[model samples]
Target: MDKYDVVVIGGGPGGYVAAIRAAQLGGKVCVIEKGHLGGTCLNRGCIPSKAIITSMKLLSLIKSSSSFGIDVQGYQINFPKVISRKDEVVLKLRQGIGGLFKAKKIDLKNGDYSNRFRAA
Candidate 1:
């Protein structure tokens, strides 16, 4: 069994940051993540929401561009494209975190680490 100076339970923002710090401090750090690397915020919450919101904001601006003396003839919202863009954004960010872990020499393990404490 491999051993580590620090084992982070999740790969969320806080957990990943802590693990990276531990590695930077010259400790063997391992992060056990059940889901995607960036956790809820990056995968489903903040990042994804922002992607969709940004598209919507752009659409709104285009619809009102006449006020700005810009001739905007047509505009359409492609739901699939919006979702795909969100997924792409999330994947890029998640990969970035993974890269950081590799560069920092932090071990990343998927799924739960189920070894409970045992009294010797």
Candidate 2:
């Protein structure tokens, strides 16, 4: 059995950041993440949506270039490619964040803490 000075329930910005801070201060820390790291912000909610929004903005700019006297034509937005790229970006950032946590020596558990730990 292992002991930790702190155990964080979620891996969202708040939880992970707290875990890292505690680890940095020399407290043994463990982060239990029910889903992919970066929580909703990095995985499904914020980062993914932001990536899509940015792609849409870029597409709009390209389409509207002629209005600014810039001759751009025959450009088509490939929806599949856009989605794939967005997924790639999100994955990369997630991995980077996980790496940061690893560098800090924070143990990352791949399941929900509530299910794994029973409150005494």
Candidate 3:
């Protein structure tokens, strides 16, 4: 097994940040993530939800464009496209985190290590 000075159990904000910092400090760091990087906040949670909300908010604004003296007509909501955009946003953010990890020389492993480590 490869040795590491720091082994972060999750790739969420806390875990990835810690791993990156450890690497920056000249430590051999490894991040073990069971799912996609950036954790729930980036994947199924914050980022995804925010993307959808932002799209809906824009639609609302466009609907009320008449009040702003802006003429708008025949706007069709492409929900699949909206969802695809959200996925793109999430992918981009995740790739960013991956890039940072690479620059820091932090190793990323995919697997749940939660059961392997314990407080002693």
Q: Judged by lDDT against the true structure, how good is candidate 2?
A: 0.88
True lDDT of residue 99, candidate 1 = 96
- The backbone clash count of each candidate, in order, is 0, 0, 0
Evaluate model 3: give its lDDT. 0.93
Give per-model TM-scores.
0.94, 0.92, 0.93
Evaluated with lDDT, which candidate comes out highest? 3
- Among all candidates shown, the one with the greatest TM-score: 1
Residue lDDT tens for model 2, 23-87: 99999999888898788888888889999999999988998898999988788989999899989
Tell how far residue 94 is off in model 2, in angstroms.
0.8
User: Which residue pairs in model 1 clash with each other?
Assistant: none
RMSD list, candidates in order: 1.5, 1.4, 1.8
What C-alpha lDDT, on a 0 to 100 scale, does residue 21 get in candidate 1? 95
lDDT of the candidates, in the order given: 0.92, 0.88, 0.93
True-structure RMSD for candidate 3:
1.8
Q: Per-residue lDDT tens digits of candidate 1, residues 2-39?
A: 88889899999999999999999999999999888998
Pairs that collide, model 2: none
- What 10-residue stretch in candidate 1 is worst by lDDT? 111-120
